[model samples]
Target: MSAQLLERGALRYTPAGVPALDATLQHAASVVEDGRPRQISFEIKALGIGAITQALGALALGQEAEFSGFLGQTRNGRGLLFHITHLVAHPMPANAL
Candidate 1:
């Protein structure tokens, strides 16, 4: 799904030596639910592992992109974590940033 990059944390390594990155993402979309158009927006906590950690850390704040991943619990079993495995940058309008 496509979403805006909200925040990114510093890259850190796991105990097993794999790189890890954590960030927050915001998603907004208009869809037809039950034959009615509606707007939906929400925020999710995201994570990238290994080589993807570097790429994720490079994304600018408010940048929009399509992310493919699954949802899981946080490391400490708090809120959900979006475990992003792939990302494709979406070109935005000149003023969209």
Candidate 2:
């Protein structure tokens, strides 16, 4: 997904001493849902672990990027977290279809 890094917490280490980063991603796009045009905008909590944590930690807030990852339950098991595994820094602007 293409998203903007809205906010991030200080870089922290996991219990096993592995790097971890917690962030929020904001996404906005237009799509067709149920045969009708729809505008979608939302913010999601995200996590970058291992080496990816360093890269994600280096980004400035509001930076746009292409993120590839999976969704999983948050630590508290009450919310979802986008587990970012790969990303392209400053992806090209989106083209209108």
Candidate 3:
């Protein structure tokens, strides 16, 4: 029933070369039906490297970010969350500006 700081890490791209940001947010809450302890996990991603960096910076500063992620399920106790991801300023292509 208390707010818990989950996990934090730098954002990076996958094997496909797509940029992304990752995060895991954990929280403890009372069960809706059984009133037992519950845990939540949050995974976030960004489409571009710039956006992921910006978001990570914001999080480091302890600022509230608009990024999207997962919310704990009262029943299943797990869920998947997706974020639209933001681009920082103008995202330049791989070739050139």
* TM-scores vs. true structure, each candidate: 0.91, 0.89, 0.35
* Evaluation by TM-score, superior candidate among 1 and 3: 1
lDDT of each: 0.90, 0.90, 0.41
Question: Which predicted model would earn the best lDDT?
Answer: 2
Report the lDDT tens digits of candidate 3 across residue range 7-94.
4556667777765655443333345547756655433322224445554544432223344433333224464443434422223235
After superposing candidate 3 on the true structure, give the runs of residues whose Cα lies further than 4 Å from its correct spot.
Answer: 1-6, 25-50, 68-78, 84-97
- Give the per-residue lDDT digits (tens) of candidate 1, residues 21-77: 999999999999999999999999999998777668878889898999999998799
lDDT of 2 by residue, 20-43 (tens): 999999999999999999999999
Backbone clash total, candidate 3:
0
